[model samples]
Target: MADPVPALVATGVAHTFGETRALDGVSLTVGARERVALLGRNGSGKTTLLRVASTQLRPDAGRVEVAGADVVGQPDVVRRHLGVVFQSPALDPALTAREALRLQAALVRIDRAEVAGRVADALADAGLADRAGDRVGTFSGGMVRRLDLARGLLHRPTLALLDEPTTGLDVLARDAFWAALDRRRADGAQVVATHAMDEAARCDRVVIVDAGRVVADGTPDALTSALGPDALWLDTDDADALAATLRGEGHDARAVVDRVLVVSPSARDLVAPFYARPDVRALSIQPPTLADVFAAVVGGRGGR
Candidate 1:
């Protein structure tokens, strides 16, 4: 078989705001029908990168392509193939969900006859069919977010860009959004920018951005494995003393809390020895999580 073309591609993309560089040589690619999560802290250029990818902002350097069209040179073509859900809710308060979809269809130049069918399909896909006639103002934050998603999908673009799409949603709403996204990904590509580690874990691939650069990129499992070793959480009366003892024995151990010790890989094999000690109270071993890998790569606690 021949090489597969990317649904979305960015190369050496950079953006600057006066004295500040919003993005520094950022590059990424999402294969056709692939789901990729873009992760970063606030002001880490996640939004800027999304804007460039969506053709809303031009990059100062480098290139962006959506569905094989250059974003800057062929923005109209890119727009035809790209759907974007902005960070802020953009629906008109007075418009009903159905009306909003109709308006969006018109803006995208869909045929009037096809608009209604597309609206119904999109609303049903988003689980908002029952509330289609309700004014957007009456919808809860989660509902409005779903409506925004439905509107983005009205045109059936091949590439969907979501910027913090789950923001403000409770657990149930967030799961619903993820399920909707899962359905979309089954048919096309999705590029999601989020600060939530749990959400990032759902993507097929994750790109961790920090200080305007791609610090790490891989499948969640690969990223976590790269961090090396399972972390053992140990609860003891003397966390500091235990940590010191483990470190003296050339083991990596640190006090993560008052009575909790985060033990390193080498220390895990020797945990049985510690467990045998009379002073050891409780111990739990777990595979490194995405959060742990994120903290290791970014050199700090994972984003809230």
Candidate 2:
């Protein structure tokens, strides 16, 4: 049987703002029930790619498809299946949560009879049902973020295009917000573009971008594991001495200031003896982290 259609797909997407290239031949796919985080630092093309994918900005070159329809060719149909929540404050402060959702439903051309029920469902999904009657200006940042998410649900989109959707939320609130997103996993796909590493860690997979290109893509654990070996960190003023001794003992060591570190494939087996050394003031074993993996893959390159 043929492979099932992906929930979202983009190929050879290229975009530029005047002379500056914002995206360079980017491609990605997210299947149904999968969540992919677009991980990148500021100005790394995350937002630009998201805009193209969401049909907010047409790309200079590329193809984008959401839920089986081409974005450029079928904008109206694509827009119906996609819910976009950008980082900016898109809601009207003067309008109540109910009013904003109602307006959104009207704008999206939802059946007039279903508007109230959809608004109620979205409010409950975002945990904003109680505050639906209150003006959005009175809501907290987290509440506003949630309401923004609720508004996106007005049409029950099949793909959620979120650019830093959790920006202003606290840890607890962010977790709660993700839990809300978790509930939607079974319906379709979620693509989150974010600079926050921890937030990206919450997704099912990560796609790191740098210099207008996609640098890496994998599950957080898979990427971390693929970095190879555990790290042994030694803290002491005698870093040079420690390196010398470790090298003498058949261990590769790199001395940086007061710390000596070694990336050893056999670190787990060899680390037990280092604790008994007199010159080793401190010894710590660090398993490969996603940050370390990300740094290795995308750090130290100049901006685009």
lDDT of each: 0.83, 0.84
1-304, model 1: which lDDT tens digit per residue?
9766788999999999888888899989999888899988788889999999888899999999998899999999999888889888779999999999999999889988898789998899889999989999998888888889888877877899999998889999998878877777755789899989999999999999987889999999988876467866677888778878767877666655444445465646867987887767888777888876665556443332
Best by TM-score: 1
Tens digits of per-residue lDDT for model 2 on 1-304? Answer: 8876787888999999999999999999998768999998889999998888788899899898998999899988898888888897589999999999999999889999998898988899889989889999999888888888778766867888889888878888888778787777776788999988887888899999998999999999888777556866777768888888888988767675567776577888766678777888778877877666665565546556
Q: Model 1, clash count? A: 0
State candidate 2's TM-score.
0.83
Off by over 4 Å in 2: 1-3, 232-264, 268-284
TM-score for model 1?
0.84
Residue 296, model 2: Cα distance from true site in angstroms:
1.3
Per-prediction TM-score to the true structure, in the order listed: 0.84, 0.83
